[model samples]
Target chain A: MSKLDQFESVFKAASKERFHYSPQELHSILVVTDLPEHEAKLYTDRIRDYLPLDGENITWATLTGEEFDDIGGLFEGIEKYRPDLICTYRNLKSQGWQWPYSLGEYLDVLTQATTTPVLVYPHPEKKEALEKLGQLKNVMAVTDHLAGDDRLVNFAISVTPKDGTLYLSHIEDKRTFDRYIEVIGKIPALDTDVAKTTITQQLLKEPRDYIQSCRDVLAQHESSPKIEEVVQMGTHLDEYKRLIEEHQINLLVLNTKDADQLAMHGLAYPLAVELKDIPMLML
Target chain B: MSWFTWFASSPTSVPASLAASQPHAHHAVSLGVTLFFLVLLILMILSLALEEKLHAKKSVIVGVFAVVSLLLADIFGLLPLSQAGRFFVENPLHEKIEMPVYIPAIDWGVVAIILGSSVFVDVTSRSGLFSWIAIKLTKASNGDPKKLLTYYGVMTVLFSAVLNNVTAMIIVGSLTVVSLEKLERREKLLGFLLIEGLLTNIGGLLTLISSVPNIIVGNAAKISFAKFFIVACPYVAVATALTIWMGAKLFKIEGLTNEKEMAAANEKVQSFDENDGIESNGFFWFATTMTGLFVGTLATASFLPYIKDLGMGYVALGFALIMLIRYKSEADKFYQAVDWDLLAFFAGLFVVIHVMEHAQVLALIGKGLSVIVKLGPTLGSGLVLISASAFSSVTDNIPLAAMLAKILGNMNTPSSSGLWWSVIFGANLGGNLTPIGSASTLVAVTIIHKHGLKLSFGEFVVKALPFALLQIALATVYVLLFLR
Candidate 1:
């Protein structure tokens, strides 16, 4: 409780962690699927058309289901190619996609085990994945705790086409918020009302402030996508689903890695599992 | 050298059961009948122990056994069927009169206390008091793993002393997960959780009403709430500190080496914003004050005029009623949240034990236990503690505590005797021996697994054995040096 320590705490509380934006260049893209090469070629062509990398000399590689036996073999293929971004659909090397309960073990491990950002295309069997081709104009970045997620924002911005709209959506889970608030209500010292308002504002404030910073920085770019922020407190899945439909978002960008857990982040897994018709960029 | 000599020489307080005037007179039954009832009791315990594997609810299993035992007892003419509405027909003076046969056996005082405490704690928790204190403790540690371990360990014990073990574990275990994750020290989560789980049992010993076993044994022994706290606090403090120290060493948790790292960690945790959990200022203060009053009232219930007569159970139920007034419209929610399965299990177990008593099953066990007590005070107490601890590690401790309390009561052992303390300590501390041993430890393992960490049953037992053994050893020495 020294003066310096007190000052450090005050400073840390006041200063929010801002998003650091850097343009991510896609030098090579790997398209992976469980279809045959001929069928995979058809899907890869559709992916190439859908992606915003129109004029770049990007090395494109396709690995059909037969190319790898398991998650290990898939990782080996990925290590050999060393793609800047891996373009794939959910339920790779598994029949889980049909059930919509998971993203299959391959994608689950792929998202967390590697540092490479994954551009998750909708399953090839889905008509929406085919129809959504050549439509990467409306990109949206979603997060449960949206503050300090610079990499996620950067990836979303990089993939968005010029003159397209980039929606930065932050949904503070109301259930979780209320749960903590309920615990606070039992505490004698805390002014529950002040806590309710101040904490809610603070929780939402960090992300809102970071999103504003994004707007300010992106405003300077000559051909940057127009930014729109959708920040509120609500159930994540329900809110995100509503926002996606309301905005007709073409691609959803989110972070998949949880620093403390081995599994994919709690919010990310359900979103990845349920939103099968939407292409999502998992970082 | 005989148990009778030891019992006669010992200075003991009059237990409530003994004061109530031996409700049912002990009668000799045929050996075959005694063995059958004993096997029935053993079967109930075994079924309860394998509850998870059997995929049968505890309440259902015990309820089935209770019905079977009652039917057999009725057939054998052990129960006075004509006096079904009376607990004790000997109460011609109307001291303990007019209760249904099953009602008297259930020990409604214990049930009331559990229900009341459960409702009160559940409602109080809705105010976010526990989480606020937890986050504050986290911030206080400045994100140092070693400091965090110590603070969380002590908090686990204190919380368990007031809250039930499962609730205590959930609150502290969750915060541990969040705090460790924030500090980027998730690698230490398993150790923190394991230590917290172990400390809960130690904390349970701190108060008469901290856990079910404590309530059962404490009530049976007629130990005052104040006395229970006084007797158990020293052991709890020492054992909690040792467990935390042992965990720190085993897990290799250490503090920041440099001031820079300390400052950074402090800054990181300071951003936690403890007040973020609070939702209602009015309710928070109300809950805080009520929690204080609840503990204060329970501790001094013996001194209070009306409450003294009614006992701690009435005080608990009364406080729960007061808390429920706030959510009077949604009272059903709190009621629904009550652990009905546990209450049902208690009811059924009481019936089974009551029937066993009718068949002289307790008298049979009492004969065997008398031999152990004849081994001299220190060695006898140590053996009982060891045996209870071992039995509790594998099966539900509630029935063990209840049965032992009855057996000891039947033998006319003193309330202040080391035997009573041994059973209390053994029943509470034995849970630390394995994940399945206690609800709190099981919860800790579940939390670890939920975070995608692998901590199998063998792994938990291996890691927790040292702490459990040391705790039981400390309890044995504590009983010998003080309680005896």
Candidate 2:
């Protein structure tokens, strides 16, 4: 079989694999915070109030940063709990506070630490935060068109506030997409236009399927959220911010690996500051 | 007297006459060479068996060892080399008799067939054809777990008959996990999967190209594909039934007792969209047709002398080339799909077997094993099956098959087909006895573990032991009744 054929088969086989369902009434969410114990409780309680958190649909546990040194240990500490989603509170450093790693470095370590999606709450909530935190009315999951965005989107869908709109958006990095097209076009068997189209389609395939998977997950839920799938062509930060403002998306979720990518474009730290009130779930 | 003692008394050298006039110097040299290769071969097998523990690639280890051994054997005159011109300078003497000659340690035919078939299967697997078929099979069963398990067993056999057992198990096992998960019988899926794993090995016995051991044995015995299929198919059917019955009893998978539960399971499984995997309808059909054609060729290749002479390996290569050309842009991907390490393993095994043959160790083993002939051919065949199966359960079957073929080929015992069948049955079934016995079993174990269904070796033995024993017993009876 050909490469295309192989990919299709794998995609099919993967689709057939059962998505393991935990036999628990409440989805366990692990909240990791660097704040003091009392402050951590407040953050956790605030999150509980903001989202549809109850003993029935969702339950949460809190862990302090000092309880575990590294991300790996932090995950291990909560392994028994089998937390579906990990919410980490990143308290942006004060002007005079001494820290070992920069916000980007710290976020990078935390995200790289686990495959689980991390719901990041930038601490010292802004005024809009309390209002937006109460309900995830409009949510958007940002994707890089890379593989495994499905997991991020799935989390976004699962946690979408009842009857709220969940947007699955991909900002197509044209540079990366073009690089692939250029490489594929060099193949003698493929015509230039055909190669370009094929490469573009291949790039869009995973992200689109991820959106579909997210939609599928949503459809199965008792309170199915409305979904909007968007594929925009431009730089990620600009397009993402635009989508966030336009959709009025309160919760933004993306891969942790993008911390570096977004940082390279001078958008990650600035975006966090700009959207200080928004809860960013870095998977 | 112990058989080992009595066996040693017999002349161990090839032809017996080689023992008569050898000088002490030459005798010492022969002993040294034999012992050296023997130790190396043992070390190689040890490494292969401990492949996971060693954290080394078996292909690299075996490939390097084979090449080094071949060179040493050739240098030491253990492997006799002849001038290429000798064949062209045909004897002007009337009626020249052709005798088998030592050429190379590696069988390019086996290498080609394995690589080509691997590539072909990889391509087909990529098309989601097998997974699609598996889903349809599940849907056809209508949410019945037992029936689904039964269909999975049959598909395992069919896929094993065409593709490698490892690939077959992965597809079947994956389908089982999905089906059972939907049925809310995830717990039972492990036992069902374990049985399906055994079936993959048995399915391999249904065709000459099913497993590596089958390929090695068939090539060694010069058994045509048709002949192999004809002999093994009936036994496969019998063995498959016995396995399913044993599995259902052991796994306690009585068909869904509750109609409502069954209906719920059916709804979930039916919800699966098989077309989600198919990238192109046109390519899927084309791939399906080509797969049918390949299997068709394998089944009929024996009757057509021209194709037979072209060799199974070449035929596989022919299919592989067509695939590469068809997917020219993705040629590199297909090429990358070939299991070079597996090819290396085969090369290593052939080289080691060649060394054994040169050292007359094979003849010695034949003499030792042939002692069972005195008890009768039926018993002798049974013994070979049981012992080979026992040994195969613990070691890689490829080398064991190679070694057994060499031993029994030289023995030229009565009911030759029975002996070959026993080796095939034993080797294939023995693989189900342990995680390391066969690639298929290992893959099954891995897949199950990945799904959070941890099955320890002891647990696997408990699940696999009964079916394995039943299959072997059934095989023994089949060989005695039919092949004899």
Candidate 3:
């Protein structure tokens, strides 16, 4: 099946699922970009057209790199406008401008700093793949933490078309978990195995509860798409790829914890590059 | 009961019998007690000078020193336990009469004013009145650096002239940081802060109650509130403008040449909620009313003999008390906000100066100044201005002001407005010469440091010296031209 065809079919099937969500309709969107001021405006204008949102109800704003650099100032903008969604391009690069961090790093930081769902296109060149195909079908929302993914899940559900399949995926990379357990054990007199077992049990227990919570939220909307939960224990990169291929995930959603840490070693950067074709909505 | 007035009314010319009957040092006090107090005072000054390095609270150091010095004075019979301030009061309604009143070395009037002004300023700041004014200015200036500086500079001067310079510095400093942060001009704020710091002192010079030194010298010289305003306002106006211009050049303020940058700054400013910091409308309005009334009372202090004699301290405290009563439940918070440490520092500093007066140390300084007084008002005032600036640059102006006021009071010269004005300029402008020179400079340095701009003493002095010199020069011109 063609990507668009598969997306529409999956969404239609998902709509039949026993879920409900009284999803809030977005009123405004802010597009933050490193593009030249005029280019940024034009780009956001194009996005507004693609979203097909009525210009009167749904206000669109274009913030350039310079404006984005002033975080305090940007927060004031967020507070005043209360934009429902923030859109931007990932891996942005520009000359004669000193970005506080790399393009991906800034994206990670911005997403983490704000509560508004950030829909980041992999690159401006990939605009067609993200916007043209139009219908959002196989949408996957990924989270390492179980509880905090509610916002991300709700966001994914909101964006997915009625004929789309929304997958809730969690990967418990054993090696990373073990390393964390080892660090905890280094705290004098901690029982490493017992602590590890307690943490593992605690960790493994949350995703199920989180999925149920998400399912309940989705249950609110009458014509929402199919909601599916997937859990895997292995290396994150390989597991994520396997899930994506198996489900034919068109768009990925993830939660960013800390902007600083995300900037230094964000999974988003590597994952975006590896899954270069997939658009991401980071919260 | 008015210690300030009692001391202020000390006889300008000593009678022959009083001078002849003045006891010898050995007869009045022992050498050991004098040496001990001097050594203690020197150490206190040293500790204050090296306050940052010592990492000790200056108030604690000086408070201990004052206690020790007072105890030694008592032990050595140097304390004037029974001394009474005797002066002839010229009552306009009645015949002049000799009046005697008790006077403490540490004048309670100065203490009351400092503490009261501090609390009043804190409450006003908490009410978001200053922030509201700041946001309005930022909006009006549209984030143009030069325009913002002018508005902010004028406001700083106005605030400092009425409120304490330290309090004014804080209000302006916080405003500067918030505005610059919005403008993404954090790198430029330090120079702006330094300039504002200098301007606070210039503002302080505009009124007798503006700074501690002004209060000291103004009281001693019996310079009325209206008289000080009339004399110093023009000098303050000129100095303020010159300081702002010099600041723009020195800081290399990046002018608003880029339309794009200016627009971004304006856009950011537009996002600021003017009501964000305001606690409540009622509180804000009430605080505003009280502030206006307080300033009104101060401006009319000269015209109202009752108010002038009631003292600036009484009025400040009365207003502060009224506010506390109105906000009874939040009274503890207001009290907490008062700078107790600062009050304590002045208390200790006052006692130390008193010790110097009792020990005849002040008399020696007076004799030195007597030589300058002989040069006539123009040159004498010029010399006093230069000396005051030099002395206050290295030490806390509070003690220096106290010491200078006493020395000038003892001189043969009577009612030298030029000399008193020189002291005012010297003490206020001199504060800009060093970070430790005045409480206001320290406050500016501290706020800048809080915002990650660390300025060393040498660096602060380097930035401040040129401005101090210019102000001193202007003050000289004013004194020689008008005051003389």
Considering every candidate listed, which one attains the maximal DockQ? 2
| Candidate 1 regions with alpha-carbon error over 4 angstroms | A1-146, A149-283, B1-28, B83-99
Off by over 4 Å in 3: A1-283, B1-43, B82-103, B412-416
Residue-wise C-alpha lDDT for candidate 2, range B1-484, written one tens digit per residue:
0001100111222222232122111322465676677787788778778888888887777777777776776677554323331211112232222222222446777788899899888777656687778778878888887888788889999999998887788777766776676677888968887888889998999889999888887877878888899999999998898888888887887788788887877766776667767778877887899999998898888676788767888789888777666678878977776777788778777776776677665655666787875568699889988998988887789888988876776655433467888889889989988888888888788778877988998988887887888888888999899886
Q: lDDT by residue for model 1 over B166-269, one digit each (tens)? A: 88888888777777776778999999999999998999899999999899888888899999999999999999889999999999998898998898788767
Candidate 3, overall lDDT? Answer: 0.72
TM-score of every prediction relative to native: 0.66, 0.64, 0.62
Error of 1 at B338 (Å): 0.7
lDDT of 2 at B422: 84
Tens-place lDDT digits, model 1, residues A1-283? 1212322233244334645669888889999888898999999989888887866578999988889998889999999999999999988776677797878788888999999999898888787556855567899998877788888889999998887999998889899889999999999988899899988877777888789879877887778898898989999889888988898888999988889999888888899888888888999
Off by over 4 Å in 2: A1-283, B1-40, B64-68, B71-76, B82-103, B182-184, B412-416
| Predicted structure 2: lDDT | 0.71
Q: What interface Cα RMSD is found for model 2?
A: 6.1
For all candidates in order, state the fraction of native interface contacts they contain: 0.00, 0.09, 0.00
Candidates, DockQ:
0.03, 0.08, 0.03
Candidates 2 and 3 compared: the better one by lDDT is 3
RMSD of each: 14.1, 13.1, 17.0
